[model samples]
Target: MSQAADRLALGRIGESVRREDATPKVTGEFAYGSDLSAPGMLWGRTLRSPHAHARIVAVDVAAAVALPGVHAVLLHGDVPGAKAYGLEFPDQPVLAGDRVRYYGEPVAIVAADGPERARRAVAAIRVEYELLEPVVDPARATEQPPLHPDRPTMRHGYREDPRPNVIRHLVIRHGDPDVVGDVSVTGVYELAGQDQAFLGPESGLAVPDGEGGVDVYVATQWLHVDRAQVAPCLGLEPEQVRIHLAGVGGAFGGREDLSMQIHAAMLALYTGRPVRMVYDREESFVGHVHRHPARLEYEHRATREGKLVCVRARIVLDGGAYASSSTAVIANSTAFAVGPYRVDNALLDGTVVYTNNPPSGAMRGFGAPQVCFAAEAQMDRLAAALGIDPVELRLLNALAPGDRLPTGQLLTGSLPTAEVIRRAAALPVPAPEPLPRDPLRLPGGAGNTTHGDGIRRGVGFAVGFKNICFSEGFDDSCAARVVLRADGRAEIHCAAADVGQGSASVILQVARTELGTDDVVLAPATTASVGSAGSTSASRMTWMAAGAVRDACREALAERERTGGADVDVEHVFRHPQTLPLDPETGQVTGARAHVALAVAAMRVVVEVDVDLGLARVVWVGVAQDVGKAINPRSVEGQIEGGIAQGLGHALMEELVVRDGRILNASFTDYLIPTALDMPPVTIDLVEEPEPDAPYGVKGVGEPPTVVSTAAVTSALRDATGLLLARVPVRPEDVALGSR
Candidate 1:
């Protein structure tokens, strides 16, 4: 054994190997959570309140119990140990108790022979409600009573507050805010609520043992957390309740928290039969959390020469009814408010309010996407005021390899803002042409409402970054157990959920690369073997799970190199370096707490807008991104393309329509997403500058495209209309109003 073979190890680190799971996924043989079935499993359904906010006066489950197929009906009183649970705070009720916060909030569950019977039985169950005032606006949360008490109305933990709807507050004060600049631009931006829109709805199966314990087969991001929450709710020990990872369609941070696991387990334990729960499209929208809707008031000051001077921002986030990661989300939104730029003076205040909107938690971009739209927009506005190129303005403030973030954490990794932007801007813009008279590709879209009208085109530039893995001092680690069999094969065991990010395949690739063996299998992720892989979020699993796999494989290889002489297999965990907590006053970190994936993106959008009908159609889009190290350059480009499509949807078409605290348009039919025909011809420019800190210097590649593309598309629209469309999902009326 010599250094030559060791160089082979380094060779495998950066090459793009074929994804192990690709064939089955493309062939449609891939099984998702909805595809799971078991013998003698009863279908579970939950009854929800029709009212947005109401008091639970009384409940009558006798009718549902009398139904022939109905085996069990469980109420709030049936919860075993904990009545409320949340990812960040214990504010959300597992079952509706004295009050219901939002419409569609689960109140009771029914287990029956089939899904239809369960639905019927759920309909038969009657619950009397005393309708209450619903606090629909976040601006009013401070003046309104919270659905979940601000303090000890339920469980008290590390921190408690005697307050109203405010769940958490994060204020970052950096350089003196009193510093004045030669020129400044002030504006406010609004971001609407965005849904995860994962292709698969929520589905799971829970089998209760006759001995008062249960086992759950569910679609989730973290199996351990699901086990923890369900064990307490079902009145069982953690050891008694085992969780197996079911097939996932896509998570994108939506499935990070508990969904139907508690309800299914509770029903199964009470009914003594395996219960299966599958949410319909509307129910899925109601069952899971959405991204936070925000109102950001931002002011940016810069020298006339384009050097960033100071930044002041006030970000108010609507947490909806319960505190679900709202505290951490506010910290994320406010702390990164200045974006991947260097600002000397900064003063920021972020407050999350508990209103009767649908509770918002983790989405793909987390909190950073919201502020990026504001911060990047400010940069564009400032560039216009100073007559500097938008790209040049950003490059002037672009953080370098050793710059300090507004949070005061040193930017240790690649901060290629200028690099990414310059290359992205150099991308070839699409050729423009006059609007066609053809009826099909008209401005009103498939509806064929407008054939020809006033049309304009515009281009925009944007830069954004999201933390790659978990931060804020959380013990974010992954466990990979690589078992070497006598037959010269390997098996990788870990609970890293594959929610369409290709983490499963990536994990296998990492193992293959490290072990230098092609014969390897990634055992299905289950709580039975591996520890928590955190959530398939923050675009972390690719690096986190891959890191774990490589570590375990490397250990096995090391052991073989020492004793087995080249055929040894072992298992181990790969934990990232620990992060330090952020300082309260200056928002500076006393230690290493910041981790990010930054991508500077630019898009040239051509559109045909009917000023009369206020309908616009995007003609084409061009993009460029820095992926650090494209482990799979092809796959990375695909992800960037798909992310841009979703971002375009957010800019021009996608929004969750909530009224009176109820999600109105919950289905794809009503809530429009982009289709293939809706997607314009996309051209992508890829850059490779490996992140030194990342595994193999591979930067996280999932969320950065999503973070920047939305603002770029919206910026183009603003350029065309000459009117600032401050809000997203720009409506048709907005264009018509601008035409006036």
Candidate 2:
């Protein structure tokens, strides 16, 4: 083979190639956004509200402005442009002007010469507030006073609902709503708010260009969206504000909403000097939006043969103070309420309400995990009532190609629901250990909490699916520019955030595979360099980026051939098939589809529980996922394992304890996440069924594991204790007290 051919074979698609930043990240040489700095840069800090709901009586920043080394102190009146900005709705104030809706809402900002000086200046600022009762309960939100009385009606997709404190309300009616089956089960499940808990906190550096323009280097999921939201608040043209993607630690949808980007830029522009802002661990918890806490009530009906007949569900999600992506999140929750089962008659209602709780937005699993827990639990109950195996019941009702979902959108993509179910069920179960085993293998590892005296073993299975890309008529597209130099090296430019999910490596691999050469490099992601690649949430980056890069590479190659192989530069915009918004009344798609594609996964978990002590330990987990294709097998496996760890955390011990809209556990010391020792042995099986419309037939691999594993773990717990276990992060008190 020629030298070029050898190089082409080095890191082609489907190979387990190493990540480009793996060594730097592991060696602590990586520079995250929090490491950003500049000469003579001032530190920025925010003064937050201590009350969940209160009316601002007066603002007093005179002391803060007079403090030594304080460069600038800004209030809401100082905002030159728009006062509010959000991902979906412009409701959240950049700085609270009149009323504070949630605890920790930014009330003022300060920039000083040092971190300590900034903190001292922020402490000097004082604002008088008139305390008001907060609306903290989602169930009673509609009955309370309107949070935004000026905008009593909120629009979701093509529909609008005129309800107080409601962000979005959607209803899905399909087939006959009165249909009933021989066997039925009903259950109510609840899930607490979960934090993204990314290692790097919200940080950014902003520098003034001395030309009424500013450059912002920040950790975020979408650069274009950030620029779009930031420019208006600064009273500058969109082109005047340039957003450069800084090194991100992790963003499982946490960075999708604005954190410190606007505040840092505002301070820098106001002071006419560079400004750097970094949040500590406690502030980081309150800075970013968390996953929506949900209340799901589901009823599943089946015939004597265990085939799903109908599903009726009511899902209420607490969207918190502002509408980040609550409209879309509620749509996802309502659309996929029945899990991956085939149900002919369905009636679903999903409502996301504004409350005094912390704002909730995107997470790893979007809105699917909350409903999956309830749907799967109901499935198990139906199986028990009908005397059928759990896995067998799921396989019988698994969604097949050409089947219609509850939204009436046909499943045309590669959805191997049954394939994954069977594969997961076929995996070998872990061998049972004898009593009085090693202390480290007990329920509470290294804690010596149990001696295996009251241990009970159990196994459980669950399946779930979610939409791949932005749905409900959102125009989703990605643009890439590829330049092939005369020296036979190529450079690919695309504004797709890596977000620690390894999309940078996937882009490089796709460029190499399509160009048939390994001499490719990725340019830094920035708003000035490339067009929108959309947000990194919704598990769409791999599919969107691969398509954009492949098209751009092929176009560059064609241009080079036409120019006698001198040099070529080309850009291409790749878009999926257009989807339509759901009908307001019927909740059915007006066009052929309402979603771009679908991905499904299944998992089986083995758990050992101590009934007396109310503790549980997951021994093994088996996962089977439909990946369409693995652009990089190693990265895919890593994503699956990481997602499972998060799911396990939510299932067993992760919750942001909030009382009366005040977060109790705002730091890692109180809020728990899964460590290496807490993770079980996860066996992953990739079902590569190439999607017809996707480039290389690759489906997203991040969300499915998270969507199903939580339900599977909870199922195992129920089996062990013979309890309903309708809530997540099952507390020891609940288990020991036998309370649902």
Candidate 3:
């Protein structure tokens, strides 16, 4: 074909194509980060603080050093340059120093011949500690002393009150606060702590480069950030600590913070041998950060006609013991406190407090999911009190194009909250049949308790929306290189972590259509080829990476057209629009780089609750999300289906139970996530609205199902039991006792 014809026939942004990673993932052949291993690599382990809050009185590393096969033991004294480091704040010690604030806080590390030897070495080390009072609750954080004095309430680090336990404080004010309405709904919502429950625990290998530097291979989200954090503690230059992402099992924001990176690197550098560290299931909970548990107080005032007039919210997130992404999480939680609705006046004050609990940081939903549950549930309550159809009421307040968010950032592109919710609600409802005296498909599903006797049914809907890309303008971006090879295939080089979201597949599908090649090879992502694609959180990778990959492909095609070549490769970067910092005092206008990517809104859950047993079964979960354009319709469906399943688990069965700041259910057997047998077949309605700015018009599909599913299930439980059901994974006693 002629160059002109080929250029004209190139796939535009909305076509469908095959994903490159589909085969490997499904066949169980893909190697996750934990699967990575090195020859003669030593295993590593960490000795943690038994007391949640304690002062380090003394440490005797001699016992551990004397142990056979123990190669190295490292601690804060071993740290070369920076004593503390964090994603946004340099408040958390890489290894605990003068004091330990959480039970899982690492004070010492050990590397040996095997994971068992490393574990035993840790037991041998004697550490003297003076116990301090543990602050377990975020609400009680302000009254107590702070965990770190360096971090304060405001953006000006120097101006903050030297109080304990307040890492980040954010306030957002929008419009005239003078606006008020007579009818209002005020309530406090409590969100429990969540674990990523990522199947593979943290694993990494630090291979010395024969220089003073080391090449660290690990499963992580941000390659650059990990390097930046690890290098400072190791007292090495940033370039010296080369971070390579290994095959990740599933991060879900758990791997966002450093787990085994620096420890393994330090050991490898000291021993002059490759060192590897992998966390056991129990160790995984202590090894990584969990999702912040939140307490939110929401006051919503609306006109009698259901027009949102004013909103006042105070959100307190439990940033357990460290300042890991606490600043960003607080900003997001407060900024979107009113949800994706049109509120004329909003006073949102959010606080992230340090507590001697398990460390919490970025999760898939960032700070938005916790707020979404409260906001949407409040919407339901408002609808009930005002006698408005919940669907119609939501549509009235849904933020459309050109809407100004609570953060004062204008919502751009296809803001389809109204369309998405409507489509989801329009799905045909399932009719329940009168089961015979014998019951096979009841709540317990073939279990003897599956009897239909005490079952009560209710359908509930929740409309949830989240900002797609990283907000507040940190210049968060991604880089991708697309090479159309002579083998009649296209290859995408991007370091965007998939985290089991199939971003690699999505990128391949985008490439296949763009270059019109069926055989698409997605090169294993590495920092060598692509620039930092940022973390896979915030649902941005699909949009940002695809934009870069497609742009590079287009550039390659243009170059090939001019040079008359069949194969061409090009690379490009996709940066999100920039955002500004929030004004400290008045919470007035601050420049924000907020752009709406693709809103994959979802509505879920019809359920039957046996109020007697506090046992509830989801009858079905119906989801509606705008994929903008499905590059691969099948994969798009997979994302929605998978996200809903995860959300279902969060709503009904998943939580990391922490007692006295210690994770009680770290293993899968104790801390239950959903199995296929646990989930109902999710009914999905694909709402296709082509996003003008995205490549192939594809909207983000991984997060919205998760965003909306929890609320829907919780809402359904409320309807079934006629109880408030304020918390998730509803307890049987609550249903049986008819507790509110």
Provide the overall lDDT of each model, using Cα atoms, as 2-decimal numbers. 0.78, 0.91, 0.77
- Show how many residue pairs clash in every candidate, following the order shown: 0, 0, 15
Better of 1 and 3 by lDDT: 1
Model 1 is weakest, by summed lDDT over 10 consecutive residues, at 1-10
Please give, for residues 668-699, the per-residue lDDT of candidate 1 as tens digits: 99888888877878888777777766677676
Per-residue error for 410 in candidate 3, Å, reads 2.8
If both were scored by TM-score, which would come out higher, candidate 2 or candidate 3? 2
Q: Which residue ranges in model 2 land beyond 4 Å of their true spot?
A: 1-10, 152-158
Pairs in clash, predicted candidate 1: none
Off by over 4 Å in 1: 1-28, 150-163, 434-442, 561-569, 596-604
lDDT of 3: 0.77
C-alpha RMSD in Å of predicted model 2 compared with the true structure: 3.1
> Candidate 3: where are CA atoms >4 Å away?
1-27, 152-163, 437-440, 482-491, 518-520, 560-570, 592-600
